[model samples]
Structure formats: structure tokens, C-alpha cells
Target chain A: MPVRPLKTKVEFPKMLNSERIQVTGKRVQLMATCLCDAFYDDVAIATVQVLEYLGCEVVFPESQTCCGQPAFNGGDWDASRKVVRHTVKAFEGNDPVIVPSGSCAAMIFHGAQIEFEKEADKDSVAALGKRTWELADFIVNGLNKTTWEGKFESTIAFHRSCHTRGTKSSEASLQLLKSIPGISIVEFGEAEQCCGFGGTFSVSFPAISSSMGNLKLEHVRAKNPDLLVSADMSCMMHLAGLASHEGKPIKAKHVIQVLRDALKNIGLIK
Target chain B: MAHQLIDTFATRLRPETKAAVYDGSKKGHEKRTKLLFDNYAKPDDLRKLAGKIKQHVIENLDTYLPATEERLKENGINVHWASTAEAACNHVLEIMRARGAKRVVKAKTMVSEEIELEAFLNKHDIECLETDLGEFIVQLDHDKPSHIVKPIIHKSRREIAELFEKNGLGAYDDEPQVITRRAREFLRKKYLEGDVAITGANFVIAESGRIVLVTNEGNSRFCLAATSCHIAIVGIEKILPRDRDLALLLNLLGRSGTAQELTVYTEFISGAKASTQPDGPQAMHVIFVDNGRTDVLASDCKEILRCIRCGACLNVCPVYRQASGHAYRSVYPGPVGAVLSPLLLGKNFPQKADLPKASSLCGACNEVCPVDIPIPDLLLRLRAKAKQEGVPSPGTPPMGGWAVMASQPAAWKAALVAGKLINFMPTKLLPVPPLRAWEKTRDLPEWRGGAFRSWLKKHNS
Candidate 1:
């Protein structure tokens, strides 16, 4: 089964549009992760478009690159430090560095401490760690409190990525999902389990990684949702690949994509 | 004794591909746990629960210990405390000798394994028989348990059949039922004829002085009931403050151990068989073994005392699935084993030092642990402790060499240059064989040609 790619051109608005976020000129930067930069560019675009549609001033630090999760997971602390130092420097002055990928956000938020603990730039890394937020977290918590008027009636299942859900926090994603008026969020059993895509772990140990993905696919199918959404594309890609290969009709989408699609219905985005 | 038993048992069993199956299953289990954890609760909530339980157990252990001893005594049970493994073993031996016990039937007990009880018993001329199905398999083959719960997880049915046949129990059978029946027939006689029965307690209720034993095979139940003298050996850390706590533990134990709602039998023995009860053991003894556990409890590693031995951490651990348990060369094999074994056996056991390094620090063990011991964190601490203690290394290659190198910027820069220069070299061209492990499986990625500091220096300037 061929992987289905989202065709819509994902783009972020330059300013806060949602009446829900009571933003009084606070700046938010979008962290288009390495994977988002290379493969899931649509997710980065969708994240920006949704935040813009929400009426928040959005900035994309082109100087931004990967969050160094790839190196971190591989046990290459120095390589991860290099990437993290770049990331911390890129979003230095931004109030919130919103990352669409849960794994990347987790790295910036929590993993940077471990990655740069003994480095000369540890103090700067620690500062960036304090301000980093997963995009859903930024949308739900960091956003100025505004009652969302957007509504979507479709049933969707949300998958929490391992690092985001297990290591970091999941309340941000859950709260964001709850805000979508009329959209029923179907809860999954054992939903906090990893989707088996441990970055390079999937390819390094394909058979085991695939089996893990297959189990996640089984649970997702159990919910019988119209779409599966998650904070991490690496996990979504793994689950989507298995679901597609098994001939399941369930489609995987980033949480931002779902929020973007909902906003588009309300005429908030073109 | 575990070393000897492992060598003997491993020599007899034919190697199979169960390791591969375990690897796949663990990945699947970890993925499921992550997905479920994400959807169910907040990280802070989970962390709070883990912290609360551990703190409760450690802070008032003194009060709980005496309370539990008094309660057991009130229920007509004798509680013996052993500060060391040798002390524990001698206590059991004295009990057996005083009772004139010649033959003993045993249930699964990691404490017994820690103290090398079988060897001690053998030396004293008392025959000991393992009655639990998995323990029986290991006993018959004269092997150490490869797993805490599933001792024979590394052995396929065919290999078990072969072991049984070698022992004159039956032919090499492919069916589980056939093999189980054969093991039952062989052990049933021992259960009836044995003079003493011994088992491990899953939890020791401090309020009631009751020893709670959970098992699926009914072996422990039969062994506890049929023998004249019964000895329940438990680690001191197994004590809980109240009977009510058992419900929470039992609920999580079964699910975490085997994904079942409950085991087949959950037996609670408070004391010696009541005088009115005709089938109860004539004498009941509960030996609470300290054996370095108090040291662990008193030290910074006290959180490890919270382990309930559910083995959920082992089932979900990626490194354990690959290496199997024997590689650790300890009675405790996975994450909990890696830390606990070193503490129990005194950092001097051969191959003990390698046990701590046997993980990817994936934290899957911590997640599935019902008691929520931060196993990966503990393992790291153990490694640091071992290094500080100057124990012989466990012979595994060092991981995170980069982290150490990165601690020194000049050294890191020089290492990066060397790494870039060697990136293209084949495994055969390397000066050492240790690099082969990484080279055989993964490729070294090309260096980016410049450091982040250099790039930042140019761009920011």
C-alpha cells in the first residue's frame, strides 16, 4: 500500500485570527522539525496555518532546524548538543517555541538538559528548555485564553507519541482535542504505549519495530475512527505505514492538520 | 549455585529463536504501554503515585517490620530475621533439622536462589524439589531461572521436551499440555511425599502477618497444604502496612505479570495451620531475609526496595529480550534484576558488573512497573556505584562514550575530527574488534564538516 500524502498546501498565518486566543501582541515561533522540514513539510505548514487562523502572530525561524532527537536517541550526546545549541539560539527571544512534533518538543523541553548537561552552553540550553512547548500545548495553554467557536462533527482518535505522552506531558494535546466543538475524541485503550517508532529504532530493528506498529494499528482499528491524529509524525508514519499495508482504511493526520481542517470549515483559512 | 545451575541447564537445552520472538513482543508491548499511558493520565499524576508508594514503604519500614512480625506471631507463625544470605540459609537449615525434614518440596522463590539454598540443602543431605512448573523445568535441567516469572522463557516446548526425556520423564513432545502433564506426574509424588514445603511470599501483610502467594499452576497451593512443615521465605521489603493494600497490588500484579485480571490462585496464609484445620501444615515458619536489602533500603538506592517482582519490567525491556536472563548471570535478570542482583550478591559476583549496563535506558521497565521503580535511573546509578566501588566490569562495551568525551570541549572537538576521518573505514580496517558490533549493524553517518560553535560564530558575527 502506497503511503497517502496530505495534498493541501499547509501554511501558517502571520497573525492571531482566533478570538479564542486573547493574544495582545505576544510573539510565537513555529519549530518546523527536521522530519517536518524534510518529509512532513505539510505538517509544518498546517501548524502555521492553524495558529494564524487562530489569530496569533506567528514567526518561522528559518534559522530553526532539527531538535536533535535523532542524535539524542542514537546516544550521540555531542551531535545532539550541536543541534540543540542551534535550536536554542534560533528561538532565543521568542516567548514560545511551538513545535508540531511531540518528540521534537520533548527534546527541546526536557531532553536538552541531558544532551547539554556538561557543555559550555548548558545555561542557554536550559533556558530554551524552559520555554519550549509542543504545538498542541502552545495552542491549548500558551495561547491567550479564548473560547473557540470552531466546530467539527467528525469522530477522530488521538495517539500520544511515546516521548510526548510517556516522558513529557499529554494534557496539552487532550485539552486541544477537547476544544474542537462537536468533534468526539474517541479514546484508545493503552493509548500511552509507544507506537514502536523509536526514531532509528524502527529501521535498526525492523521486525520488532513493525510488530510494535502493528499492535498500535490494531488498537486504532478497534476505535473505528474516521481519522487518527497524533502529535508526532514519526509515530504516525509508522502506524500509517502498517495500517496502509494491512489494507485498513483508517487515515493518519497530525493534530495540527485536524485543527487546521476544522478552522478551514469556519472560513478562518483559505 | 546459580552460576553452576545456569551452566548445567544451558548446556542441556537446545538453543532456539525465542529471543527474536521476545524482541518483537517487547517492542509491541512498549508501544502499547506508551499509547495507553498517553491517553490515560498526566505524567505528574503517575509520578506522584510512584513517589507516594515508594516514600511510604521506605520512611516507616522500621514500624512496619515490627508490626508485621508481631502480627505473624499473633497468628501463630514464627518470623525469623536474617541479616545476610548465609544467615537466612542457616535459619532455614536449622528449622529443617529441628523438624527432622529429609525431603523438601519448593515453590518459586528468588530469595532461595539468592542464598543458594539448594546447594546448602544438598550439602546438608536434604533433597529439595521445585514444584512450580517453570521452577520445576529449571530444577530438572539443573539451571538458574532465565526470567523472574517465566524462568524457562528462553526454552521452547521442544527443548523442554528434550530435557524431560533426558531426565527419563518422557519423550521430546511438541505439545504444551503433554509436557505439563508429564511435569505434573513427576512432581505430584514429591508434593505428597515431601516432609517440608517451601515457597516465596508475594506480599507480607503487616496488619495481619499474612503471607500472600499468587500463582497460576496451583503448585504453591498444594505444596503449602500437603507438607507437614511449611516455610515461606520473603525479603523484608515485601511487607505492606495493611491487608487493604493487597487489593491494589493484586490488581496490578496479575495484569503486569501476564496481562490477566487475576491469577488462578491467590492464597493468603496468616499462620501455622489452625489446630481445627485437618489439612494445614503442622508447622509454619516465615523467614524475612534482609541480605543487603536493609543496606539498599538505608542507602540512596532504597527506591529499588519498592519492587514487587511482577516482572512486567522484564517482559517489556528491549535489552532483556535480546540478551535473555542468563547473560546477566544473576537470579534477578531484567531491569530489577540488574540492580537488585548486584545489591543482593554483593557487587563481587562474577559478571555482576555487566548487569547494570544491560539496558538501552528506554524507561519501558519504569512505565510498566506496578510499583513504579525508576529502573533505568536505578540502573544508571548502579553503574556509577559499581565504577566507584572499583568492581570488575561486566565485560560489555561502554555506551555513551561521547557523553564523557563531550564533557571536555577540546577532547570532543578532537574526537569529532577523528570520528570524521574514520567514518569511511570498513570494520576490517578498524584497529579493534569492539567496533565490529556497531559496524556490522549500522553505518557511521557523514560528519557535517563543521561544529555548531563554528557555524554560530560565523552566522551570529
Candidate 2:
């Protein structure tokens, strides 16, 4: 079955940010994330565009790659550590690291707490943990900007990925969505429940994982939303994957994509 | 993949995953635990006080337990220690045989469930009756206690009504009170006439030589009052130094467990005191069962011993909400069970090897735990253990392939670029287990951004 694009129409006001956040001339190296790098190219593009719109310099370091969560989650710490070392070195400068996916951001911040053993690597990982932020969180708390001006008219149910809940508070995504003018945040009952996209978890306990996604999608169907949105592309892929196969009406999207479309709608970016 | 375990997960989770049921369970659990925790006038003070009290007990268990045994002995309570489940059951059976006690009445006790005490007793030509309403329902149906505290949580009142009918209780309405009343009427006789009563303690108070039991049902007292031989089986982890410490534990335990301010009936049993009445128990026995808990205490996951068995962790766990207790295939279930079962049972218990992998590492279980056991962290450690021990599936990578693929940036990038084409490959030919699983329910996403290296070269450069 062909994946269906979200059919919700967007409307926008002239101003993008209700209050322009002061550009600290600070750097936010965007961790385009393995998921965004592979499948959701636009999510990565949208993340960069949104950051630049906030007057923040977004850097995509070539050395940056997968955060090694796939291996970390699969209990292959050796693989995780190697990739993490490469990622740590890639994002080495003191600039705050902003990851597009909550699961990846959480891996750097929370998962890093244990993966490193040597003093130097441990210090580096902990420092990275302090600077790392999921994109919505980096936008709202890191930049101190709550409102973004955009034209969005859609009823979308939000799925807060489990790692996002584990590593950081999920209010940033909700706050950012509310900032958009015409966006209707549909109350999906199980939004906080895991979509069961636990990296290797989806594959390992596939039945439970599939059951979890179906449950989440069922909640989305109950809300009867135009789109099912989440911060983590892993969740988006898992949910959209199952929804597309099952021929469910709901389409999965990264919240960043919705925000990006709103930015374009309001002429904040073309 | 453990096909049997997967089937268990699938069948149990399918019906309950409905928004009203799944989210409702999560909501009820979170509300119950968080309300007490958040609204507690001094939540931190309470947690710290309870934590310190438990820490003190666990650290000095060797000292406190013997001291407790001495005190119980002084109070005329026969103290017995069992290092294993078989030993624990033998102790109870030997006592039951010594007293010629055939009918045994029980209260809500997960420890006995851990030891499979009821089945052992039944095999020894003894009848074991569960006096608590939920436990009774579970007993009648020959099912496992799905939730530690709420034994029949997974069973609806209608199902319960049917179970009661099957147990020869004729007809009853499918409401909670109706079923509860029927159980009350039915079990009242067992509690009054049962030759021996077996119950588990909430906390074994070492200082005063008393084991505290808190039950909402009035059965705990009836069981103790009615039997001549009363046996209290308690975990070594349950020891607390002082009786006064029950104030905070009881407060948090009740609130965190069922959202009640306190369970209606909290009884302290020191021994057979004031038992002049003909019906009152004449003798009391205290059984301290190690049952692999000492091994748990010795391990790095020892903090799991701080668990008060409040079932608060079970209340909030997403997997527990989905799979319930039975899907775990262990007497223990939920997030606490996920970590503890693997450690306590060790490698010989093969079914539990995949139990930790059952969770999504969501951290909700730890978030809601009153004692604050880092369940997700412990689960991760188990995942590492499975890998270290050469367990073949569920988080243990095959031949360290992930390490080889992930270490080389060139290989990682090549894999990324090839991910799109891999999606189109013949499904059976895909070498990766995750890829195979990912392909089962949904299509693999296409790599549309091209290899990130080229994009970064064009953009970041």
C-alpha cells in the first residue's frame, strides 16, 4: 500500500515567532539522526530550517553519524561505544548538540551515563550529555523561545516516544504545537504510552512491538486525527509503517515536518 | 524469539491494549502513586525516611534477623529459616504434619506464590484456601495472580462471578460488591475452621519481634484467630529495624499501592498472645525465607531488595499493563519482576532470560517506584548480562556483528545508503533480525536524504 500524505490544510499569520529569541550567536550542531538521514530527509531539512529561522546557526558536522542507540539498545555496548566515540569526536566542540529524534537525544544524554568507562571518555560523554538536547527542547528551553508563528490547521494525535519521556520532559513538543495558530491538538488517550519502537525492541519482541504500535494507532484512530505525530523518527517510522500496512487512515509525521510546513505557510521560509 | 513467550505476549496484550483499558490502567496507576507522592506534605522526607530504614535493615540483615529471631523466640514465636524455596515449603509442611493440620488458610502473599507453597501443600494431601477476595478468585480459577496486590486485576467482575459459580457458589451478580460479598460469605468458614493459617508479612520488625500485616480484607485477623498453628512466611529483604518505621512505609505503601490512605486492617503479630479463647491460635511460627533473595542482595542489583512489594512498579509499567503478570511466565511480573526475576533465579531459570527484554526500557516503572529502584538501569544491566553470558537472542548481538558494522564509519555509511535498497530485497534474504522484524508489520523506510556524508559535505562544508 502506498503511504498517504497528511491531508490537513494549513493556515498562517504573518509573523513567525511571537517574540524573536536573541541569537546568542551560539551553535547548535544538528544531529540529523540515523532515521532522518535514512528515511525522513525532509525532517532533517525542516529541523535545520527551523533552527536557522530562530536565528541560530545550525551546523551539520560530516563526522556526525548514528548515535549508536541501535547497538546500545541491542546490548552491543562495544558497537555502541565505537560509534559513540566517533559521534563524540564529531560533535567535540563545546556547542550544544541538538538531535532531531528524542530517542537519539536520550541515548546521548541518558544512555551515555553507563556506556563509557574510561575517565577521559566518561568525562566527554557526560559533557555531551549536558549539552545534548532533543530539538523541541533545544528550541523552547535552550533558545528560550516558546512561540513560533506558522499556519497549521490539523487535528493530530501526539505519541511521546518512551526514551523522550525517560530522558527529558515532553512539554516542549506540546508547547511548540500550541504556538502554531490553527493547529488542533487532538487528545489521544494513550499518547504517553510507548509506541513500542524500542530500537532493537521493535525487532526483538516483534509481536509485542507490533501490538504496541497497533494500540497507539488505535488511539490515534479514536481521536480521528489527520496525522499521528511524534518527536522521534523511530516512532514515526514504526507507527507509519504499521499504519500504512494496515491501511489505517492516520498518517505518521515528525512534529518538525508539521512545524516546517507552518514556517513555509507563514513565509518564514520558502 | 521465544515463540511461546511471544504467543503469551500477543494473546494477553491484544484485548487489553484498547485505549480505555490500557490507558485506563496506566492512568489509575499513575494517579494512585503520583497523587500520594506529589501531594505528600513532605514526599522527600517520607521517601528518605523509608529508604534509610530499609537500607539500614538490608545492610544489617545478618545482625537484625538473628536479633529478630531471638526476640520472636522470647515472645514464644518459633523462628525458622529457609535458604531455598524447597526448604521453605518443607519447613511449613513439617510443621503442618507435626500439628496434623490438613486445611491451610492463606492471605495475600506473593512470597508463598514465589515458592509455589499452595501447590506444594495441595500435593501433600492438604487443602489450601485463599481467604482474600482477589486471591480466592485466582485460586478458584486456577490462575496466577496477575497483579501482586490486586491478584485478580486482569479478571473482570463478570469473569469473577463466573469463577465463583464454577466453584459451586451458585448464582451471583456481576458487580464487585456482589462478588466480594459472595467471597466474604464463602471464605468466612475457611478462616474460622482452617487448621493452619499461612500469611506473609509486610515488614518484619526486628526491634519489637513483630511481623506486620496490612490487608484490606478482614481475613488476616480471622485466619490468625481461628488456627492453632499460625505461620508467617517473610522474605529476608522485608526486615525493618523498628516498628515505628511502619508509619512512613504504611503511609507510602497504601497510598502508592491502591491509592488508599491506609489499608483498613493493619495487624501486628508478635506471637500467640492473649489466646485464651478456644478459637484463637495457640502457637505461632515465623519463617524467614531467603529463596534466592540473598543472592539478589549480594548482586549489583541489590537495591531491588528495597522493594516493599507494594506493586506500585507493576501499576505503572507499560509492558505490565499490556502483558499483565501471566505473560511474564514467572511468579513475579512487571518492571520490578523483569529485573529481579532474572537476578534471583539466575541463569538456570531460562524462561526469565528474555523477561528483561520484554520491556521497552521506558523508565516509567522506576519513575513510579516509591523506593526508587532504577528498574530500567537494572534491565539494561540484564541485557548486558544476556550478551556477556552468550544468550543468543533478544539484545545479545550475533558474533558482535553490530560492533563490526558500527565501528567503521565507511561501513556505517554504506549500510545507510544501502538501507533503501535493502528494503526492496527479498524479505527472507535480509540478514538482520531487526530488519526482518521491522519488515513484518511495516515497510522499511527509504533513505531519501541520500547518504548523510554527501549531504554533510554539501551543507556543513
Give per-residue CA lDDT, model 2, range A77-145, as digits (tens): 776787888788888887877888887877787676666743366877877777778888778877888
The residue-by-residue lDDT of candidate 1 on B1-461, one tens digit each, is 01122223323333464443365446546544554455446533443354455457656677778878888889888889989888998998999989888998998888899888999999999999998898888888887788877788777777788898898987778699999899898888778889899999998887777889999998988897678888988988887666786766776667667655678899988877787888968888999988888778766567788887778777776555545677667788878988888777654534475566555455667777776676655665565566556554422333345334433445544654565555566647765443343333233223433343343344335
The window of 10 residues in a row where model 2 chain B has the poorest summed lDDT is B14-23
Off by over 4 Å in 1: A1-25, A29-94, A99-130, A144-161, A167-270, B1-15, B19-51, B343-353, B383-461
Candidate DockQ scores, in order: 0.05, 0.23
Q: Give the TM-scores of the predictions, in the order they appear.
A: 0.69, 0.87
lDDT of each: 0.68, 0.75
Q: How does model 1 score by TM-score?
A: 0.69
Weakest 10 consecutive residues, lDDT, candidate 2 chain A? A9-18
Tens digits of per-residue lDDT for model 1, A35-134: 5544465677777677776676677664655676655654445556666676677787837677787677767665666545457878787667666777
Model 1 DockQ class: incorrect
Question: Per candidate, chain B TM-score?
Answer: 0.85, 0.90
